[model samples]
Target: MFVETEEFAKRLEAMDGLEREAAYEAVVRWFAENSGRITHHMHLAPAHTATTVRLGGGEPIVTDGPFVEGKEVVSGYAEVEVADLDEALKMARSWPACPIVEIRPVA
Candidate 1:
């Protein structure tokens, strides 16, 4: 599932440099606590752009922005396979910072 902070984009864009750093740090700490259960974690840099391109000869599409625009962009995300969505949500709620966790089934 994909977990991210809701409204993060807007909040981050409005925050000062120091506040952004602090917020990022808080998120990192949250992930650290659950790192063992996570298959992998990736930090999305601001420079990254959104795109819709299939690996094989599927389809190519363009989008205006990331799937969602909020106070915080998905600065980072973790991959986890849990028994059920409820269990995944439980882990998401454990995050110390105020994050909007988005749960998406693996395709």
Candidate 2:
């Protein structure tokens, strides 16, 4: 949902229609292949308009935006269950998004 660089915009524009479709198809294929292992999935809206809500011992405190200001914010979530941490790491690594994917176990 987000990219940090102005250069990325130029690169994105260079992608032709078929290339864009192929990239999307590839991602869809990955999801289909791993569907059995995926426990939960969610797609979130763009983060810019996100509202941050909190409570400080009284009434609910609502803010106009994200918890932190940055080009990088958690835009969505996926929950997967693998054999172990190593397996989880392998799955995360296989994602096309690569380094952008963060795997945190629920406590």
Candidate 3:
């Protein structure tokens, strides 16, 4: 799912230790509950760790940071097999963390 970095930071900063722990558990529980629908999932490293590659012309260009500068970056992704787009939307809407969840179809 895409995460708004600033919003995520703010969210964590507003929570106490106990609240943070609870929030973590809520996310874990969400994953557990949707395990059947999820085929694969992964949480990516911070945007700063990203390596961007651009191919064009005669040579390829490599960069040290994310491909683009934006309010939201893809922090994680999940491959879910649901009956329809509505079901996918429902799942995304219930995500416990990450202010933004992007639902896209796989080819």
Instruction: Give the per-residue lDDT digits (tens) of candidate 1, residues 1-107.
Output: 33345465566688999998998788678777777778987766552465534344566555556655654455556788688988888887877554556777778
In model 1, which range of ten residues has the least summed lDDT?
A: 47-56
lDDT value for model 1: 0.66
**Pairwise TM-score winner, candidates 1 and 2:** 2
TM value for model 2: 0.76
What is the lDDT of every predicted structure here?
A: 0.66, 0.69, 0.88
Which 10-residue span in candidate 3 carries the lowest summed lDDT? 1-10
- For candidate 2, give the lDDT: 0.69
**How many clashing pairs in candidate 2?**
0
lDDT of model 3, residue 12: 84
What residue runs in model 2 are displaced by over 4 Å at the alpha carbon? Answer: 1-16, 57-59
